[model samples]
Target: MSAPEDRPLLRVVKGAPDDYQLAALTAVIAGLASVSPAEDKAARRSEWANPARRVRRPLQHGPGAWRASGFPG
Candidate 1:
């Protein structure tokens, strides 16, 4: 195994002196790593285009409504 210093990302992390800088760099790296390829990404949508996919329930008397919504009885 090579020394951590020999690895580019590890070298950068090890060279970060401040705790805040290390934290910020880690967050940035994590965010970048989470990015999906363009073709695999879902199209931007403001709302569910299909009404069938939306949750629908008639407004009713109090506690029973909570039960239907999957809350503890």
Candidate 2:
């Protein structure tokens, strides 16, 4: 059998949606979009709060370690 080709779309209506419809739509929207800016910032901060998970760890420059690692001292 052939696959379906039409994409689903949302239509504007004059009246507001019912409680159930609103909840379902909210869930769907939440699933599609990312968290709020504040929440995202908090998440990033939490990640960086842990030293092991940090993007830049303390560099160990023993003698010429920096030059050996291809980084200018």
Candidate 3:
């Protein structure tokens, strides 16, 4: 791999850095901010559209099975 490609996925530079480093950090921050809201909105909309999807009560007591549970027919 080339030097650039061989670099770690994440890098931390201590102390002061050049303008390029600041620009790169700013770009990364901006990119993250741009995508985060869309992702959150999509997640919220999906939750609202599909919901948790819980089973209704009496799932195990379908139809006339409730009559056998000791309650009045």
Clashing pairs in 3: none
TM-score comparison, 1 vs 2, better candidate: 1
Candidate 1 C-alpha lDDT tens digits along 21-66? 7788789988989998667677677666776657565555776775
Among all windows of ten consecutive residues in candidate 3, which has the lowest summed lDDT? Answer: 36-45
User: Top model by TM-score, which number?
Assistant: 1
Q: Which pairs clash (backbone N, Cα, C closer than 3 Å) in model 2?
A: none
Query: Residue pairs in steric clash, candidate 1?
Result: none
Per-candidate TM equals: 0.35, 0.27, 0.31
Estimate the lDDT of model 1: 0.69
Q: Name the top lDDT candidate.
A: 1
What lDDT is reached at residue 51 by model 3?
Answer: 46
| Better-scoring candidate (TM-score), 1 or 3 | 1
* After superposition, candidate 3 runs with Cα above 4 Å error: 1-14, 37-73
- Model 3 scores a TM of 0.31
